[model samples]
Target: MEKLKPKLFSVMESYNGQQFIKDVTAGIIVAIIALPLSIALAIASGVSPERGLYTAIIAGFLVSFFGGSRVQIGGPTAAFVVIVYGIIQTHGFDGLVIATIMAGIILIAMGFLRFGSLIKFIPYTITTGFTGGIAVGIVAGQIKEFLGLDMGAVPSGFIEKIKIYSESLHTIDLSALLIGAISLGILIFWPKITDKIPGSLIAIIVSVLLVKSLNLQIDTIGSVYGEISASLPSFHIPEADFKTILQLIQPAFTIAILAGIESLLSCVVSDGMIGGKHRSNMELIGQGIGNVFSGLFGGIPATGAIARTAANVKNGGRTPIAGIIHAITLLLILLVLMPLAALIPLSVLAAVLMMVAYNMSGWRQFVELLKTSPKSDIIVLVATFLLTVFFDLVIAIEVGVVLSSFLFMKRMSEVTEVNGWKYVEDLTDEDYINDIENIKYKKVPQNAMVYEISGPMFFAAAHKFIDITVEGKVKKNVLIIRMRSVPSMDVTALRSIQKIHKTCKKQGITLLFAHVQNQPMSVMKKAGFDQLIGLNNFLPHTDDALARAEQLKCS
Candidate 1:
């Protein structure tokens, strides 16, 4: 009875009487910021403006209520713009809805599997490359929208997307271009004046007023999509079949990857801000639920927004109440004030998203990395970037993982090598080591000593050992191999060692292991190397092996 009480108690605990006003204020402020961008991102994504709001209201609320991170804010964001737009254009919204639902199922399963920590395994280079690629694709997509050109149902492929734009360059509408450029300019520089109100929101109001008052000849949302439904979301289960299911898989994967990266990255950024930890698996579960509901409500996909989450933490939102309030504020706006949103200009929304692309890009960091990082890493960076730009996000990710893995193996192989030597601690005593009169090993004949090793012998340094054991390179005899350096062995290194041992045997020299570790001893013992070599040979030290060599030579 009491256990059920705590679960209920936690939900009530999230609401604070004192902080509610502050949360409302922050929510309203953020809503103002989210409005223009949401509508623009929707339109740019080949959906209507209402869908974006539906995502913000429904998905945003669910994530805040159930998510592990207190400060995370959820909404339709710029990150999903390219992928969603492509999916809708190709497979239609029904396919997208199926994909979103499938992705939600995958995410939910992943959460239960506790696979959240695995998201960290994705390399930083790959993220940077694909993110940069997405940004480029987004910018290219908007050239048609921003310039108000006739794209004739816009191509889904990247090269085709570009070709469509280039061919229609002569059809640019000057009124729309002026609106877009001016809105972009205001958004870019408005932070210098004041941030109490978002520049995009203010630009939207100003542009709408200008267009309405001056009777500008540019396009408007009402002109294109009639009027948006400023209402709360209702449940929607899209029709699914074999064809829809098959088509949905690719987009579903893209959504899952995007959701995973975006959420984890946001959690990481918030951790830095609050000096706190979040349960990744719990957060993933929450995101799964959020996205599931997001699709059910006819909303675009949503994830943790780092900037808004940071803003929440920075402003005194220590609980999930702020996120909940954000949703409520949008809901209130939808119910009572949605009709007012039509006054916001479409060009202003594009400007806001353009700013989003700019902020997310980190071009300076990209260029700096290219200049400083190794050629191999740079190759991955450039390939992912180009593929993301010229091909598809899914393809870029696939090839990037393969390339990164192969390069990582090659780098590890380059440094892995083995060498045999008569180790002396003191180099200054080289006179005694080199001098014919005092050299310790001078009396040692060839084919007497053996040194063996057993451990995690891997590709990180396996090649040099092969080069060193070439014909005519022998300097000593009966080399007692000290097998203590090894704990485990891979097939490649084992093959190299076996080849060396075979050569020594062919040359009529005895090579033996001394003080082998139990594990490697058992491994070699089982492999019959211990039997083929004659069991009386292995010695404890180089000195004993030298003595054995001397005795055998004389006898």
Candidate 2:
């Protein structure tokens, strides 16, 4: 529970007026950076611009108040755009709400079950692959707005989108294209001038002003979505039938996984920036609470936005108070200034997302990985990337994880060795004191044979062990199995050994184990293998096992 405690409560012990001022200033700055981004991400996610603010205000507040990280700022991020859009298209906004709530529950349960650390097991290759795919997907999604292509209802799926966009190239509005190009140029170059204000915000302001002053025939948010609400969102309970819930389970799980991974990654980044440690499980709980409330308030899925969190840390925010203030600032803006957002050009937002996609693509890392990674890893990475682009994210993640697991097991099985030990070589000078006794010099009965087992004895290698031990034409009166190198054993391996013991007994031959490691010993003891093979035959070393084999031969 101590590890699950929120950083807000801990930071409150040293909270002061001076730090509060710093937090307030930092919070306001992050809110300014988040303003245009939230709107752009919301519109990109196939939801209204105001829903993004609702998410920033509600989820952001809850995550900051209850989260483990001192400087995490939570809101809708580019990563969720594709999945959210797909869910809304398939199941409607109500279905999305239900899925989000279920995802929140899953996150909370994961936190309680201490699965925070387990997320690290997700292979980096898979993450990189999917992230690149998502970047491409985001760029594709924005084409309709970016070029202001006059198309009748853009279709879903990557291939279908490309086909529709290609067919609508003739309808590109010159005004929208010019505004988009200008916004993109601003986003790319404005960072050279200053980092205090976000480039996206500047781009929006410049494009909106141009459209208004020139009376350009550009499609603004107002033209598309109508009048934007300038008030707080009203909470409503989401309702769904069991069948719908069951149907949406996969998407719900995907949302939970993305939220957990993104939030934890943000926490890690913020922790490094501030030189602080974060309680990951507590962060998951905070995210869970945030998403549940965000869904109820008509918002889409939300997670920790890395850019905003970094912005919070950079501007002297050292506590969760900054995050809280960020949410409050956005809320105030929503109440007073949200309607102005409608005047912003959609092309400008599309340009902002284009820049976002560029950053999120991680193309450099992907190329580097391809150049340096192992063949098996490259397979996983490429498979995940292709699946995400050509198929679905759910399929990509599921197949990627399964492929990684199988490849890992195959590699493990390859390294595992079960060898028959012949005459031991004379290397007394290099041998340890315990291994000084040479089996070559020892007088072993002619009817006895020794076999050595190495590496983990899991199900993957269990069959190999069995085939070598039990399927051979063994004329030996006794078998001495050396397991000093066997570090671990699974039930399948244990069952394999039991089968060997059974075959040896039926053939009137004795089975003896030498130097069994702790894990295998415990398994054998628990399964009564020691008693079944006779307790006296469980020797501590090869010499003892040889002595026992000699006795069995003499008997």
Candidate 3:
């Protein structure tokens, strides 16, 4: 079980001025990188640009203050864009607020219940598939903004969005295209010039200047969303009914699951960079607190941003202080300079998001998995990806998890086996007691036989156990069973063993066991199978069982 203690408390005892300076510098730099990204992700999520800043300021502050990771930067992330858009479109902004709040409660409960370690059970193929799908969805959503197409509301469906974009191609504004191209060029090449300032900030400044000087007829944030709010976010409760809460359960769960996965992943990555361990459950609680407040203050869902967290590490951030400073810096910018954000062209932001989407895509890993992974993994990957792209994320994740579980069970069943022993000269199969154990050299009475069971004995493999152990037609005075390789047993497999004991009794054959491991032994003892078979029948080794069998034959 993980202790719900924040990293801040642990690091502060040894904190010094030198490290504080580094933290301050790192935090400010991360804030600069997060500014445009927060805004872009918010607009992409179908909300006003200022809501992004609100998330950065509010959620960002709370997560850092209470989070488990030393330098994790929390804010609006690209992963939530598609889901946020869909939720808002289907249920409206108020409904989204309610759903986000519900998600916060779910996360909080998960943290307290110690479910942090279980997040790893979600298959890697599913995560990769959905992440790539999200990247594609982001690109699709940005198409209109990137091309400056004259169009109304874009469809949420991927195929419909593509069809709509194609029909609207003729309406592309060349000036907006030029801005997007120039912004992308700056982003690609500006880091070579200097790494002190973020390329995104530079791109936004240049794009704003270009629009102002050339009087380009492009859609700026102000033109689209009106004057950006410089005032602080106001608190308001989202109204909901019993029916609405029930209806929003799936989406809320989706948000909670994604937030948990991404935040923990960020913690793992940052732990490697800083050589520090993070309390995963604590991080979940921090995220829950951040999100709950973020919704109350009119912001979208937020989580630990991997890119910003990495940037914090690279720039000398070593404590939660850095993350705290980053949030404060964003707040200052929101109060002092938020109005200027409206002057930036929407096309430039689109290009920034396109870069984000490309990074999120992970195409290299996807291709490698496709080429080298097993056929079952390939099916999960493809199924999750297609579902996310064509359908919705809720469906993609639900189906992917269920599919992976079934495939895992199938693989487990394949490895389980029950085999009768053979003489060394007959064949040296590993499954049978052979020359490896030198058991074949032992003299076996004509009235006795032996069998070995391997792998986990679960419900899926119970039938195989019955077919080989109980259904055998051979009648013998004594029977010996080996189970050294079996690590565990379930109720179903225990029942099969019971069947074998009953059958052996009815046939007037003595049933004996050898090399039973702890788990299976416990199950048998708990179920009173030991008493049923008689305590003396359970032998420590095959040699003992064989000796006992000889005595039984003589009797």
On residues 366-431, what C-alpha lDDT tens digit does candidate 1 reach at each position? 998899999999999999999988888899989988999889878866644354544343335556
Best by lDDT: 3
Model 2, residue 244: displacement in angstroms? 2.1
* lDDT tens readout by residue for model 2, 311-426: 88889999999999999999999999988887999999999999999998889999999999999999999999989887778899999999999999999999898887653333
Give the alpha carbon lDDT tens digit for every residue of 1-555 in model 3: 677998898899999999999999999999999999999999999999999999998899999988889989999999999999999999999999999889988998989998889998989999999999999999999999989999999888999999999999999999999999999999989989998899999999999999889989899999999989999999999778999999999999999999999999999999999999899899999999999999999999999999999999999999999999999999999999999998989999999999899888999999999999999999999999999999988899999999999999899999998888642324445645545465556555656778888899999888888975533454467888889889999999999888888888787889999989999999999989999899999999887887798799856
The lDDT-based order of candidates, best leading, equals 3, 2, 1
Q: Which of candidates 2 and 3 is the stronger one according to TM-score?
A: 3
CA lDDT of 263 in candidate 3?
Answer: 95
Clashing pairs in 3: none
Ranking of models by TM-score: 3, 2, 1
Who wins the TM-score comparison? 3
Off by over 4 Å in 2: 424-447, 469-475
lDDT-better candidate, 1 vs 2: 2
lDDT of each: 0.74, 0.89, 0.91
For candidate 3, the TM-score is: 0.95
Q: After superposing candidate 1 on the true structure, give the runs of residues whose Cα lies further than 4 Å from its correct spot.
A: 1-24, 423-456, 459-491, 494-555
